[model samples]
Target: MSLLDHLSEHHLLVKYTTKNEMEEETRDEGNIRKEDQCNTVKGLKKNWQKWANNHSEYQKHNPFSNNRTVTVQFQKGEEGYGRPREGSRTQQRGHSAHAHLEKEVDELCMIIKSIGEAGGDGQTRVAFGPLFERYVPISNKLVGVLLRARKHGRISFEGEMLWQRRDDDVIITLLE
Candidate 1:
């Protein structure tokens, strides 16, 4: 049922016993509200640090670092502001940098495909599936190769197909 219905059914508002005592009871509840909020903040920060450490370990090779270094500093009695600052550099430049990086990565993939498709000697055709599958196992290595190929204006699609293959049976089965 809805929160209002549940509270009404439990006689939550009737706890004062009489109408005259309602204001006094509400004031008592208000007094402990800040303590509850402080406890919640501490709990949330503890959970965040735990999860952030795990994330940093998993994505160790990622250029973008996880929030392992994130600090949650708040006064004992203060409820910190949750809203973003309108004039912050993080709000303005950060978004543009993120968008630019995404576009660059997408372009790199397209370039890799083009290079892989056009064989230098013009012989047998290279398939994308097998290449993508093989490359995924050594993604760190493959990323380096792609970066080098991009510099020379070549998109290496030769192993693109291999990277697409699912070497992990667990992941493939989950999708099925």
Candidate 2:
């Protein structure tokens, strides 16, 4: 008997199997008689309406429906396709300073511990230039490190002139 007749007799959905799937079945399992599979579908029901309802529900709530395309225009001599565009000078400086501070956190903590241990007072006094020379060998990232340390409750200003002092001038005490 034909495949459609076999499917209809057992209440199986003919649309569920594509032409490619049917071809693959014929090529791969040709030795197994269709009657054996057809007999096994005795209690199965062909519920096309239920499948259609589920598909409609899935399409309604699909996230890809909200996706939109964005276009960026690049002018002449502007590097856009390959390399990243440079940020504003102030923003770049701030980001680099912040990164430098983060990199120096452990070293700064160790310096504070050592200074506090050496000093007579329980708090450690850290001046920018000496601290910078001690910890950061290459660049002066002491201001950012001290500011971040202050924000994190690791240090605080000792005097009233916090931001007014020169690079080598400001002294901050380590918090216990």
Question: Every model's Cα RMSD, please?
Answer: 18.6, 16.9
TM-score of each model, paired residue for residue: 0.23, 0.36
Question: In model 2, what is the error at residue 79, expressed in angstroms?
Answer: 38
- Candidate 1 at 17: error in angstroms? 91
By TM-score, the best candidate is 2
Global lDDT of each candidate: 0.51, 0.62
Predicted model with the maximum lDDT: 2
**Candidate 2: stretches off by over 4 Å:** 1-66, 69-103, 115-120, 138-140, 158-165
**Candidate 2: tens digits of C-alpha lDDT, residues 1-176:** 99977876565344436667767765777787878777656524346656778666554544355424333546677775343335535468878977866667767877867754445766767675566566666446666667777788887775433442364666657776
lDDT of 2 at 92: 83
Cα lDDT tens digits for candidate 1, 1-176: 99857986577666657776876767787888777868987999999999989666545533355645544445566674442335556568867976865565555455345434444554223344444455556353444554444444444333332233443221110000
